[model samples]
Target: MVGVGYTLMCEQTGPKELVEQAVRAEQAGFDYLVISDHYYPWLDAQGHSPYAWSVLGAVAHATSRIKLMTYITCPIRRYHPAVVAQKAATIGVLSDGRFTLSLGAGENLNEHVVGAWPHVHQRHEMLEEALQIIRPLLDGDNLSYSGNHFEVPEAYLWDRPETPVPIAVAASGPHSVALVTEYADALVCDNPDAAVVRMYDEAGGTGKPRYGQAAICYGPDEDACRKTVHDQWRWAALNWTVKAELPGPESFVSASDHIRPEDIAQLVPCGPDLEAHVSAFQKYVDAGFTDVAFVQVGVEGQPMFLDWAQDELLPRLREL
Candidate 1:
């Protein structure tokens, strides 16, 4: 069965709104929640980036049934893997084991604020080491490791969950896919690529949950939907390599300057057509994704979108 989840774009909304949305999503029949962890919004127009962990704490109390996870968190920089393990453990306990920790190599937009960003291979190496440190700690074991990129000095998680919080690694390439297969409990990607699933399975990730994301704009006016998507989500069209390297929101704005409304409309399902929205999600399902998260593009249309999803889109997807 396809697990239809909602994407809480912390970059696009404040903490209070995020918690509120989580409650609404659960009520609307979304099976789980996937939230983005970012220090900055992709564009100034997208608006806010509250600390995702704190917001998640609020979500845990406010909603009870829905499973929660970071769409992807970067533990190699800005945050040590130890701290991430601790946070995930505490949140898991607080949520009564309804949380998963989704990790990635991270992007320069968030990590570059601290210091010079490393090369792609170097970052992946760091991530591998981080997973090494994180996995044992989450299992309630004391860890000691000296790796090329990280050092864990006899670390232990005092507040770990009884069952370790599952780690879902986000991968967009062969190397990352292999890393996830080796280290992660689940595999995550944003696009509908069957080859990614095949690669993960071939690399020993068979039977693990495969998660993917779909971005859409739901509104009555097609023109307005196109404009909203262009203004807020043009960054969606950038390749992961470009996204991983760009320094800040300004760089993203410049990179997306040539992106037109039609360009965004073509990529993201826009307007209020039910079939268009259903088809957008179906692509990921067709690509063999077991879990799919939907990100609504504009704030103004969120309520309508959720209502429509509960009344129309979700039931249709469930039938598949």
Candidate 2:
């Protein structure tokens, strides 16, 4: 089945607004919610980066029925796998089994804040080790691990949900796709890349769910929408290779200095055209994604987009 979800971008809004948006998203007929976890917003202009786990806990208490997930959280560096597993379990229990934990190899922007930044290959290795620690802990098992990247001594989750929390691994390449196939319940991608899904299937992930996220700015004023995205999300158009190595938001700002509004408009669906939004989501479905989350770039456009989604885009997607 194809599922449509809403994205809660913590980088742009505070915890209170995020909780309110979650409630509105569910009421607007969204099937699930995907929240981004970050220590810093990509651009200083985006402003806020509330602790995603704390905000998610509040969202759990505030909303019922809608599934919640971290769009992607890095388990290494700033957070230990054991701690992440425990937090995920508690959130799962709080949300009544409507929670999923999405993992990524991580970028320097968030991980560097802790003063420990590994090489790209090393980061992937750390993620694999993290999964080794997280999976069993979420199963309510007490265990110790001695990996090159991390060590845990008889750590166990005391408040795990009756059912183990589901894990969705975010993958943009073949290596990560293979990694997720072995450890995750689902595969998540930011782009509508069919080859990533195909690689996951070839690596023994044929029946697992594939989740995708796409960003869009929906507003009546085209220039205003483009300007907002250009200012807040121009970093999105940067290559992952560059994004992975950037140390902080200031570096991102310097890197995104050349990105123009027209460039962003070309990449992201901007303005109030229903077809533009519909087509953007359709690309994910056509790419074999079972679930897709639309991230609204303009914070003020959220309610309007949700209304349009509930009344227009969702029904069109359902017909697909």
Q: Tens digit of lDDT per residue, candidate 1, span 100-184?
A: 9999989999998788999988998899999999888899988899999888777888886678899999987799898898888
Q: For every model in order, what is the number of clashing pairs?
A: 0, 0
- Local accuracy of candidate 2 as per-residue lDDT tens digits, 55-159: 999999999899999988999998999999989999999999999999998888898888779988889899999999999999888889999989897898888
TM-score of 1: 0.98
| RMSD from true fold, candidate 1 | 0.9
lDDT score for residue 238 of model 1: 90
Q: Which pairs in model 2 have colliding backbones? A: none
Q: Output the lDDT of residue 158, model 2.
A: 88
C-alpha TM-scores of all predictions: 0.98, 0.98
